[model samples]
Target: MASPVTRRESRHFSFISLPIEIRDLIYANVWAPKLQLHVFFKNGRLVTAACLGAQTGDESTGTRVPSGEEMTLADNRPRGWASRDLVILRLHSTWGNHYRCEEDWNPMPGHISTERNACISLLLVNKTIYAESIRFLSQHLEITITDTDTALYLNDDAKPVIHDSPPPMIPRQLLRSIRSLNVTLFGSVDLFIALALARDYNATTPLEVVNQEFQQKVRATMDSNQERAVGLLPKARQWHQIWPGIAALPHLVRVNLWMNHSSFDSWSNINERAILEPLQRATWSPEVELVVYLPNIASDNIVPGEQFNNNDEDGLNFRVVRRVRCPDRVAEDSRVLFIVHDMSAREQEEMGDQGLSWDLGEMSIEMDRI
Candidate 1:
């Protein structure tokens, strides 16, 4: 009988030797965002659109109000929070509690809102599909999640137990296993970080003073209450710290931060090196392609299969080896097609006439009966 590590190593061993293009095609399509399984909203109602920002809110009403380029809801996210922490977004109960008003619950509010049943919908598929999704998608993107909380692990009750050579976090393993990466910084915090780095995350004069005051208070909170949390610092600095590992990955030939002008650093090499230094190991040269999406300031920025067009000759930084706009596909398939089982006729009709004519050994999509 084979040992666990040996068995696990053999799991994707077949793909290990496959042609590069074959591997990438599988990675791209398999990991591509599944718009069908997920739901979207438009203009404060649950509607669909060709683009994510189809039904964005009023620009005059601004980022403070519910708009399409929305992120985590105002009610769910802790205001003046740290930039790296995503704990608030993942808590389903928290979302259920806040995000009141039926209008607030409207489906679209594009660009990925974290509010309950909003643009970002993650279904808890069985462990195998989740595992496979992570594995297939990890080859293209170094999926780093940041939260603003001082505590690295939000829940105190579930203490993080480090095992000797334990199975790595699915996201980490995917990042490590892949030869190329298409990294993304979704969520508002990442947006904020990109803006700060790009010198475009701006505010009014009085708003700047207010933000500074808020930052000072946040600093005080960390010093007073969360001083012991591991790998945590001030929100601004934490964003700066998350990039080095991606650059160092020997297999990473291409990367997309999912940001725009609000993200490209003048000293990108330095920024990339900073992330790579700690994660460096003996390896090959993977000249990464970094892609950044500019700020989409509409409320309807949450198109699940949202594609960032690469038609512009100057839209991309030409320095990297290969950079194609593969859309924001990472972390999307798992969210949309949460559970896909080859279905019977009954099951097919149940999923709003998805019309899945799947046979055994064929692929299909399913959702838990609500």
Candidate 2:
């Protein structure tokens, strides 16, 4: 008779039954990845790794140069070849290589390993999850611009595949929704001038002429018998031209500018004040704050972990919050932190030893890290 007692099944609870705040925190913890968007202008295409995946180069994709036996030490490589494609930065083989200098192989540029699908996965979890996940991403996106190639846009054309979704790129509308921007601007006067000139020239020059000249140059660089690859249009845009659009973003609250080591031969040649004077004069709403990062500067010039005080009004209130010298890397590869006075001492303490942190919209600055 006891065998007749049937087993009852345990009831499953709905995740939505939890408080919205708790649900959101859970989503953030599960979806956190150092979501960085790498933007580069290659050929004529303005590519964002977050949208269209990072461009693949010869070394990265394992495309080997011709056998050493096929090439001689006297062979002349094309000029600006390495600049055009960064994959050749490493010495693949020592044989016949003229530059016998010691070579330390740097990892292939751009993000090699990333949780590229975390956000997408959360989006597909459910409708409520999708909304919350996307909102989280929109607020926390860190866009790192390393090249001023062409005008950047997030559209159907730039979208890449994600979980079979046709247009996986973050929507243009979503980009405009972002509130905080973190950028690493390589300090190079020559590069900036060239970019500015390119932009200026394009204003007067026809697009077709630019494309024609770009194609001709590309063709000239390749061997006559080699199959020509599809070339990008000539990009003539400067990063500064894009600044106005960025500043105008309705939600923008803060900007983090990291001054990377100058790509030029020596830092002594840079007129640091003159180069940065333009930005100092640039206007912004009182609500917005600017943080400047001077990486690898001498400790004697500026003390680390303390705000630099000129003790005067009307000057931009700049503070040195922290200094991080990557131990494994060269000394010049360190990061010196600076923040606007708008950020309180409490806020600086909260950000202690943490990598670039941001708070946008209703979200608190204590974001869940990957």
lDDT of each: 0.31, 0.39
- Over the stretch 98-167, how does candidate 2's per-residue lDDT look in tens digits? 1111121122345243334335455566887667766776777655554333223421234443454344
The CA lDDT at 268 in model 1 is: 20
Backbone atom clashes (below 3 Å) for every candidate:
43, 0
Q: Per-residue lDDT for 1-370 in model 1, tens only?
A: 8556667776877653777677557656644542221122223222222112211112212112122222343243433321102211221111111112112333323324333322222213555445655555544433222222211221122335555444322333333555543323323223332223322122233545545554555455342222222112234443443344444554566543333111112122113322222223223244655544333322232232222223432533322222211111111121111112222335335543443222311121111111
Error of 2 at 310 (Å): 6.9
Q: What are the C-alpha RMSDs, in order, of all predicted structures?
A: 20.1, 17.1
